[model samples]
Target: MSRRCELTGKAVLTGNLVSHSNRKTRRRFLPNLVNVTLTSDALQRSVKLRVSANALKSVDHRGGLDAFLIKASVDDLSPKAAELKRAVQKATASTAAAA
Candidate 1:
């Protein structure tokens, strides 16, 4: 499988590295991904996901891995849920700008 973050949709990026001599070299920037198991009701089993460190951090910071599931209800959102959401959004925007 590719090194893609299923949670945040982050993937490896390709670009060029410019040196002081004005020479450019090809380079790859891989996302920080980890293989994690998440519970799934449809399959009645745990599903593995390749998620970025930032995405995982957002989930854990809000609650835990369970919150990363798409089907998870928002009723149980933590008191700091909004903060976490904003943080994730900001991070994503910053990444996009950098790219």
Candidate 2:
């Protein structure tokens, strides 16, 4: 699997590591990614995802996985996350319609 966040789509960034002697070396800045299982109220299940620490915090800040997925933009999300967002939206819409 690639070194990328499944939620925010954060990936390795290329940069230069400069030394005190003004020497610059090519380096990669990787996102702080972790494997986590987040529970979705809409799905009534837990989903495992590789996400950055910042993305994880944003998910929590948004209240839950379903809310975060709904609020996040499709352009910023990974393919899997975009799919999950659609599923969550569908589930919530159906539930709302039933109610």
Query: lDDT of each structure?
Result: 0.60, 0.93
Tens digit of per-residue lDDT, candidate 1, span 11-65: 7899999999989999999998787775533234455666777877776775655
lDDT for predicted candidate 1 compared with the true structure: 0.60
Q: Return the TM-score for candidate 1, rounded to 2 decimals.
A: 0.54
Q: How many clashes show up in model 1?
A: 0
lDDT of 2 by residue, 1-99 (tens): 999898888899999999999999999998999999999999999999999999989999999899889988899888888999999999999999999
Best lDDT goes to which candidate? 2
TM-score of each: 0.54, 0.96
Distance (Å) between predicted and true CA of 15, model 2? 0.9
Clashing residue pairs, backbone N/CA/C < 3 A, model 2: none
